[model samples]
Target: MIFDKLKKFDIVFDSPEMDCPPVFSSGDVVSGKVVLELSAESKVESLKLHAEGFAKVHWTESRSAGSSTAYTQNYSDEVEYLNRREVLLQADNGELTVLSAGRHEYPFSFQLPEETLVTSFEGKHGSIRYWVKVKLHRPWATVKKIKKEFTVIEPIDINTPSLLAPQAGTKEKMARTWYRSCGQVSITAKIDRKGYTPGEVIPVFAEFDNSTSRSVVPKAYITQTQTFIARGTMKQKRAVVATLCGDIVGGNRRETWHGRAIKIPPVGPSILQCRIIKVEYMLRVCVDVPGTSKLSLEFPLVMGTIPLHPFGSRTSSVSSQYSVNIEWLRMAIPEQPEPPPDYSSVVSEEEAVQNSTEVQPEEDLSGVLQRSLMAYVQEFRLRPPPVYSEVDPNPQPFAMRPRCMTC
Candidate 1:
């Protein structure tokens, strides 16, 4: 009977362009309409609209006591960026309003706060979201709610002098096992700039020198780290957004990457403004040696909303549609925690060697569908043998196959 009486109820957002999504930033005005359709006359109590934006992080960990007892602890935190409410329809002088309409529309508008806001983000254990909810209360019926979400993109300009600066780092790791010194491997790498946007290419130039007795494989990854802080403790989840690998270098051989490009996929802008949740990006160039820890070079990266100009001018470049859709951007992250090696802390003690294999990048990367399919292929790999491949004395660069190791 309720379904028969209520024909339709929906909330729709207005966009500047017909096909584009409604994307806003700090201090922006968001306007939308609520539609209702009724087949017969109905009595209404009150209608309210609420808009809110905040970052939330929650996860649970299990621990054991001295014996068989078990206990669970929760790590959670919240940081509010916005809270606004407005009344659309209400009772007049404590009297219920009776409506005899076939179709009704209620328009609402809310201006975001002037303070800076973090970009919209979704992660495994945490998320930063903005949404508007409508609540309808009736005399004898339970309250009904309708919610719609939006995307907020705070601009990060890569044209600034700070972001335009080049980043370079060099790190070396000794290859040793059980008090035996096989040798050492060191990497020197640099990126053209520290800031990049979606669809842009990062030119990686690096040199890997291996003096070990066994062969080594060189690789690069664009990693995204999601950090959640609560009660003075922090938890981090990583996802490999993009990957590129080089050829295998034989023992006592050298390897180099001359502007090997790693394209940035469509993802949310870096969320450095949020306190409870932080989204960071890093470019890692690593060496996978045998029977020892690998050497790596890391550089901080800023994913921005603005793209670099073709002629290096101040002219603005437009962002594509994929960047604004929060849902699509969430899909950019892998479902599983398919991250690369934790090069953050290399094997200082030469713990255990990790084996890796090669994965072929798709030939046609023209559309999102193909890129998503490529993502699945690159993340899953078979366990490698003692070495990735036989000692190719040549140690030539492998251009087509860019892989992410499963180990």
Candidate 2:
């Protein structure tokens, strides 16, 4: 049985054997079974063990100072993108056992903090590292420790400094912009039809250069503020060239706001307001800004509107195609609603009544008065009129006629 005396013990890891997920987002438990297999010819006093988890972040920034002819350089960490440390687990002496001869497997498991698993790692630079280490304590000069790179990833914790005022003085202040596209934005707009059939929705679309330092949150509006004479009836439609009520489609924010940062990364080259309702005879995009001047966007705006539909139904029935370019320049008009039109000047009740009576010809005085009474009759429409196109004479003219003419 001297072979039993040759038995010695060793520890091994399984979860992060090669590479591990730094933070296991799954609420499910993360565990590892440590197999304590004994050698055939080894004797062991006791197996004392512990597992420790660690995480860290790191980054570097380089700067250059220049002179008239030459420039010196310096290097340091970018303070804006700094790193932090977090302890994942510490299972100290969690497992200890006196060994019996031959080979055996011991399974060990541990639970990480609930909040730590779901905690965010946005916007932070450096690397997130994790691993499990086991130690074998003995009656010797040193304790053996085994370490491995279980997981590595960039932390998601990104943050920007808060400010009370807009950063306007210098580029350095505006450096808060995370990502900037060095390309130009292009825009092209068009209407679906060349001419409009009155009261019809005109489809408009804008294709533009999406390259920008900021993400585009685009809106559209239309207005009939300008008038073009119509061949038929003059019913015009107007809208604000830009409106924020539409949906955001085709693009995303360059950086997500994790609620921890004051400003988010810029995003752009997006397409918005593609719905039919957002379409109009003319269309324009109005960019909204938080701190930066929205006007800075070089607006080569493309505008077109749908043609009016033929006048028959309250709803537009015929659709004609129309296209026209509109120029949008800043104006100083009072931004208040235009006062309601002066109804007193446009129409009067007495004129309306006089026009109605004269338009219908009647043959007799009784017939002339009957038209007025029939207009108010509830069931008159269903019943046929007693007579049509009857003529009427003025009472004054009848009075002036001689007795012979009357006879």
Candidate 3:
């Protein structure tokens, strides 16, 4: 209990108005307070607080040479965007000799750099993190410290004309066995545009022609590719964010898909601003054929903060049919007829009379019986009556017993 009481320290942000997973961009001021509660007067040296935002990448590899010579190589990279240190209290300043046995609060603030910074990301090889740390210095004991981490997001806007332009790609591949043509699979996939925001749906149009002898399944997905470069060595990672698998296509048949959309998720935008990390998005469609190699095509995509305007708002001179083929396909897909009326809605007069007879009027016991039941319940109430008892207004104090005999 004594040690638990002596180790009390807390750091809290002053921006209560910010939502959970507090968000901030460049050029924002972050302020917070550090609180220390001492069970006894113990602190002697100084108190320091640090605020820092940085990205660090560390990876190691082992390389072996011929005949018993081996070496380990380590790669480390760090970028510090914000670093601020504040001395809250110091013994050399002669402000106070010893910390009192009470609570103390120190306020600190720092302005983030106006330059763009990478968003906070935690990957296997690297991480971009921002944190606030507080340290309590003592004479003979180890330093006591506390730290808190927060998130930093850099906004990427997609409102530019270049990002809003439509992106499309088509690829064709042939399969053969022993110099004889087995079949050819041709796939053409297109998106309304490259730019997209989180929660925004990406409309995909695909036409697959499978002239092969084997059955093929068409699959489409959005992938986030991250490229990390360190010391002239480049590493790449890819994650599929969304996918759509179409119906199987038989041999010598064409399958057209329209109105297929993949919604974007809350992922980091393209890492064009970061020097060592590069993030890119792609819309990939692959044809998986049984007993044969798969044919795939990828179209680059852009994820941004703003969603594209409606197709009608686009002022480009491109023909409407070329820009949005789904609108045309909507007219081609057969529409279902209106649903028939429900049985309850189409009740005949005789059926109505029968239903009325089944629903007899319910009895209303809302009069004297309800009153009597309520009265009976009130009489058996669990609460004591609020009657006043005569007692002395002035009372003498009594001696309290000790919690333990030793006390």
Candidate 4:
């Protein structure tokens, strides 16, 4: 058979059940086998298997001065974890004398660390990655190698009291032109607390006062800020993760927003511990006029691993209304299931599918090796926009006087 006359190199994971895009957590054991098949006898020096995890960030900036433009590149790489070279076959040890060749399987295993590893994240300018590699060494020919990547996620818990306390921010701005004063605008925004887990709703409260001659529009949004540091210089990228907008406010009128909710996503648990990268969240409220500068307020937020208590038990009726559009909110939150247990703990009747050559019928095996790589490439190319809820048409107007006496 043609298959019996060809050489093959493959890496197969030892899992009870075959999983597409296999997942692993911290403190887990990753075991697999490397298979080598050859129909003809060949010279061999050594065979080695390697596994590693790393994070890398890169970006470029361009600045124009007159008719000339300058471009600067920034990058950083961190090897979060690594396991190197477990020799499977060595000619120096005289284990193999290179007689007949058919199929050979070598088992390999690695125990991941229990701490300081974050979930795998792939962004436009940065990525956290893990991979396994196999190398075949020959005396006179170039070395051949195969590599495969996997996913790792670290659980985040948000049950801390500090993150649950109520948080608020206020900002007031006076608009003034060259010769005339355009009056003033004030904004105050608050959230139920600072700490939030993925898939949980966040209630927001805001009061806007438009004392200026021109009408002002009110907007609120959640922002995620990612910072990358390289060569002692820092670069930051910001994305609006969720937003809600209120109706326009007439001059001399005040508008109050209540029961507005924004849902957090599974993409975060914060990236503060990472040395080269950092992730932060914020809530911002802004009031915009036709030509004058806008007034804005900002409140810091924390993404955690635990969900808040029930609204009825821990919050008032206003908070209860936060779930007014529960169905819509559900669509925004991504599903985050718990990581599968170690392969040893699970019971299965069938043999490991990854070890079976029948699983891959295609002539080229590169597709199986590059599955994770392709997924990341697609993710970076087709990043999805943030989800948003419709603005409430009838926001209640506050009757109290403007908090800023000058306005």
Candidate 5:
């Protein structure tokens, strides 16, 4: 009689309670063994093993403010965390055939590349840990994983600062890791005069600045409208309006417009006649870097004022000044006209001239000459009547009569 008895085994990690290295410093070799209990007299096909681990770091940047009132004080803080490091172990497996097994054991080992590891264990430590694990696999048997944790002790460093006192200007540069790039841009508007006079041009100018360490290209634009003001339903006032819009590329740049100066129309002091600065709209500016994962940042993209100037204020005065965060602005594609159709049919010289004549009306030089001649003939035919002269028919022989009287 032949008996086809199946082989059974139990897999266990050597150190189930012990933790792996807290931080896999560069060139650290992680080791573990698989403990197997073969059932009484059985045959096994094969055994497999796998080991994996990784190192990672994450942090955030934020803004904070504090205010003190007569009764109480308050402080506010905002935090933005972004992952900085990631190194994953490649999956590796080893297989072995078992001819006849009563009991067997397998060991596994692996190494983490030193160059890829970020050794930030000393300066900013509070409980940042990277984990590693060893896994054992057997043919037709359950797989077992062994997880270990360890403390990452920093090598003594005189320059290292305590966790509570992080040194200034400290930064980490890691490739393939996510980074939060920040930049500050300002939007300013200025009028030629403190106030604007009705019916006069008010010069306007704007400037943008990138204050953050990260370089950024910003969008900028400008707009202006008329606004009106009235006092107690009595007198009305008019003011010139202006605004800046569009993306401002290269943080340090200025857009100047001599046309911001607008002439106020002459009108009586009435609410209906009063004109006020109106709608001022602009697109939000933002840093557009391709390939890099875009981290979301909360910042103002637009800032400006309407009726920028108060009514009944001095003439030739500034209307309003506004600044917005680039993030808040929306992106838009400028409207573009479609291109003309390509010429598929070739035309001969004669056809080209014919088409040109057909496209343009022929001048009627002969008709113009005829009209002019007709006008001239009409003038001559309708000339004013010649003045009639009364002739002195009795211009008699006054000399003969005078001579006779003298005799």
Candidate 6:
């Protein structure tokens, strides 16, 4: 039988000269060879190949229908980044081609599309994937098919002006009881920079104050947010990627973190070049109290393929003319791990802290905290027009010459 004669069929990629795992990016040429080994002769009509890259998101959420009945809502969307096809071998006029071969190799190459592509990622509800497939057609036998997947990485440097800027936020929440208030909880947190690569350490400094009757614990988390949009609606999923916990603070006590370290785990680079689906990261510092809702301060984070340059290497903010190192482009983008651990697992009694001050009304408190989150970032849209006194502070009392009568 043909199965006995056909020993092996496989595809292999050509290694780069640099030997850094032969990573690929947009507009790259991917060259590889298909190896076929057989002990006897074989006949085939054609061998063809197909390559494609795409991102897709799908998930179902449950909602109430009645007291016990529930209905499901599905959200799904997809984007195609590349598609290409090739014919490796074929009979000139659809005739079966005979091959008496012990070892055969068919080389192939593909030019990835120049369009922007999101890095390879695997998440709970979606994934960005790239792959190539091959088919071998025979006259009177079943067609043989094989597939292989590849990684696509888009470099993101951390030395840019926005990413290099420090991030900080402050939020306060009241600790209330049924009859009276138990004081308040507040948290102020800051990070040195926003952009980072996998395995890099984030330096988090924060102050936590607890005036509530209940003990408070301080915890930090690196979270991944996956957003999927369809039919004018959106669904989101958040997973905890990394976590840090601090000791408990009793009532009327405070705790300070001096550069508390949180190391980032292996994760895919940010996906900003795609539509319909977005992958984002953030740092959440929370103070867990005994009875009330946990108070949290959130700061956005950017995950990138390239690390920040060494200290003193960058004299100023990254300019448009700035270029990334070639070595970084050659490194493979990390594959995002399948759904991280649950967020509830990180909560512990010994790891809560809260800092609070007298603040009335929820909306006003949120506005004040958001306004105080970053001194450097200004959102004029969220802020009303500047308040000015009716009378000018410095009156420009220049005596204009009386010219109305003469004109």
**Over 4 Å off, model 6:** 1-4, 17-21, 60-75, 289-291, 312-341, 345-407
At residue 15, candidate 3 shows an lDDT of 57
The predicted structure with the larger lDDT, 3 or 5, is: 3
Q: Which stretches of candidate 3 lie over 4 Å from their true place?
A: 1-7, 17-19, 42-44, 66-70, 91-97, 289-293, 305-407
Q: How many residue pairs clash in each candidate?
A: 0, 52, 0, 5, 42, 13
RMSD of 4: 15.0
- The lDDT per prediction is 0.68, 0.27, 0.59, 0.59, 0.26, 0.65
Considering summed lDDT, which 10 consecutive residues are worst modelled in model 3? 372-381
TM-score of 1: 0.77
**Cα RMSD for predicted model 6:** 14.4
Model 3 residue 370 CA deviation in Å: 60
Tens digits of lDDT, candidate 2, 1-407? 32234343343444433442232332334455444444533333243344333322232334455654554332212111112222222335644334555666555545444333211111122112334555544333255444443321111210111211111110111212435333333333332222222222323233323344544544333321211111221211122322222233233222111111010001000111211011122233333332332312112211212212244222222334321101100111122233212212212344324423221111221221122111000000011111211122332232243322201
Q: What is the C-alpha RMSD of each candidate to the true structure, in Å?
A: 9.6, 32.5, 29.0, 15.0, 39.6, 14.4
Among the numbered candidates, top lDDT falls to 1
Top TM-score model:
1
lDDT of 5 by residue, 44-122 (tens): 3334443333222222323345464233322222111111221122233433434343445555555555443322211
Better of 2 and 6 by lDDT: 6
At residue 34, give the lDDT of candidate 4.
87
Residue runs of model 5 more than 4 Å from their true location after superposition: 1-24, 42-46, 55-96, 99-103, 116-156, 159-407
**Residues 71-156 of candidate 3: C-alpha lDDT, one tens digit per residue:** 99887777788898998878676644477788878888888889997776655556677899988777666778899976566766
| Model 3 quality (TM-score) | 0.69
lDDT of 1 at 388: 26
lDDT, model 6, position 234: 62
Best-to-worst ranking by lDDT: 1, 6, 3, 4, 2, 5
> Lowest lDDT 10-mer window, candidate 6?
372-381
Q: For candidate 4, lDDT tens digit of each residue in 1-407?
A: 32334388899987655454455768888888888888887667778888888777776665566787666654566656655558877867665446357887889988888776765656555767788998887655567889987666564444467765677777788866664678878887777667765455666667788887778888776666666666665665555556666788998888776646655543355666777777777776786654454466777887654344443224321111211122221222233243222221221213223322222111111221122221121011112222333344543444453433111
